[model samples]
Target: MKKNLIKPIVAAALFGIATQSALAADRGTPREARELFDQAVKFMEANTPEKAFAAFNDRKGRFVRKDMYVFVIDDKGVYHASGAAPEALVGLTVLNTTDAAGNPLFRQMIDSTRSAPEATVRYMWLNRVTNKVEPKVTYVHKVGDYVLGVGYSAPRASADDARGMLTRAVDLVKKDGAAKAAASFNDRQGAFVKDDLYVFMVNMDSGKFEAMGMNPALSDTDARGLHDAEGHALVAEMIDKLKSAEDATVEYVWRNPVTNRVEKKRSYVHRVGNSLVGVGHYIE
Candidate 1:
């Protein structure tokens, strides 16, 4: 009698374990997140910042409004145009604007665009109308010798909305067992992931590479063919050579062959049963 009872208990435990494992297997893994990030970057690059800026400036631009100020800048951080005060910022140097520590708050963004034609950055400024400090998002584009920037200010309420959207997306991905979820900034349709060192944009339709902010070296072709390109091939080789285990966290940096600027990224690939999933920052 005792042996019969033990067998049934063991069988029940095994059944429970199998059910849990199946549920886990059904959820997506980190690989899904990495793929989405890659796709978003490709989409961003296909749409050049200069063209995007022009569209924003057009009469029918999506962000054209009195409450929202859109503008462009140069490599030297001078204002190219400001929807709110174009004339006032025409000659002003943005680098001069510093925080209490005297650090150029825009340092990372400015450095990234020095070579590449486009990049994006975030900052805070005082709203003249409301007399309050607010956050601003700017997409910087380099054309010839000058840099062009398009920007919009977020109200406190809108900031909450943006954060909420991102959080919800992240939660959905997590609940679905996805390793990552990718999305574009509200004003700039470029890709950003929680773990990426920089943002990336590639054109979705044309398959053209546009810009990489964290790494300026990534060019049109480099950004376009990340998965199959020779550069990424070398990256995979390096990972295999130095990786401790099949599951090590690896960093991959690709410089544009033309600009020699670097785009730094990290990814972790894992095997769940027979399927492989990658998660991490492909686009920052």
Candidate 2:
């Protein structure tokens, strides 16, 4: 009886693991998602709003078709172009509207874009049609006196994509059974680690890793949470560190209070005007 029970339990466990692996394989990676986003950005930048709007509305735009609505907002938060009839939304205002979940989406977009001019702001919105809240990623830029906003939407994944990427990375490390694999993975993804710690560095401008080979699980904190706390500060630090040194590296770590882990991380800061920019742990 014990042997029979163990067989079935083991089979079930294997089946579950196989299913999870298959699902992860099918889903898009963070890098893939970012590349797709870059393609959309390139499309918009290369074309006028009218042209981009039409392309996004067209059925051939697979990115728009697979994800959420595509739309643009001006600096003041007015809809300039929409996947829907652009003419209808040309001058409509969204600054006052709450997202499906009642959050002030417009204000958040403005603030984020203003703070990180080159970075995109990702948020969640309730899709009234699906009655589900999905993730929305928007890249905003100043075009003349108005801000050009281009966005793509997708159902939010269970684990934030950044955390998922980190987890996948850890899995890769475990699978390879080598420390070098961690550094290799980070290098491939443009991330870096400081020595043997979990703290990692990622370049904000190029969105790559500056230091490679670090532990990923030390902090017990998700990327989004870290971003909330020290994303801006980290960016500033990177910029300041870049002034005197063209090829400079900095070491850092993050303490995860919940897990009581101290992550080892590294950073290579770069100068961005009077500010410092580069990537490292999301913490300050």
Candidate 3:
């Protein structure tokens, strides 16, 4: 009986993991955001605004799950309902509100929806629960006099994509020197940053950040003592590994920008002159 039960239990566990992986992938795509927006629109059409607003504003509503949430705004960019925003945002005009990157995301959303039935926009936003800035891709659709939107945390770049970015960065550093390469890394819209994967450099001697493609604020700071979620001194480990060779790889638990959860990350580091250029990809 034990042996028979073990086989079925193992199969069930594998099935559960497969199903969850599919759901996770679905929730992180633009199609999912559009679908959730459509659901919010249907709710408003079926019920009165008061009833729909109550449902949409619910923190745990069907329209708001995972990292996606539905927000409703009037034609003039006044808030009608927000699934996970603070209560102070309701009934307020937010046309000028900007994302963490100073991009007028609300303004862009309004501009796109005013002319089209639906629009897709990308911006950087702060995850309120995690207090971390992350990239977001939002889908907005105009319904009657309201614009309904659902935004998903952007997906992480694949390991192959991240490896390619690192290769490019390494080649650039070899040809252009560290100063010129730092300029490229500073370009947030440049090739160094591809989706969720970005390049980071640290001066081996000074132990200071020379450049960070993801967050410019992290540049020019001492980061040698940086630790992972489990108190592992990740930067020190990288530096130690690079002391004997030109390249090294390290793995640790890190907060994933897409999921805002501590997950395993594998990083590739290359010693380029006095600086160490590296890139990492989260492992799901």
Preferred candidate (lDDT higher): 1 or 3: 3
Query: Mind giving the per-residue lDDT tens digits that candidate 3 earns over 1-284?
Result: 88888656533321122233234433344566667877787777888877887888786668666656678888677888886552645677777767767888888988898788889888887543333466677878777788778787665666787788899999999999998899899798887876567899999998888898878788889879889889999988899999999999999998765555588999999998889999999876
- The best candidate by TM-score is 3
Candidate topping lDDT? 3
lDDT of 2 by residue, 177-261 (tens): 3344435544533442321223244434443443333344322232222332233344334444565664355554554321223
RMSD, every candidate, angstroms: 22.4, 16.6, 15.8
Determine which window of 10 residues in candidate 2 has minimal summed lDDT: 13-22
Give all candidates' CA lDDT scores. Answer: 0.41, 0.46, 0.76
RMSD of 3: 15.8
lDDT of 2: 0.46
Lowest summed lDDT across 10 adjacent residues in model 3 is found at 13-22
> Would you list the rank order by TM-score, best first?
3, 2, 1
lDDT score, residue 162, model 3?
Answer: 75
What TM-score does model 2 achieve against the real structure? 0.39
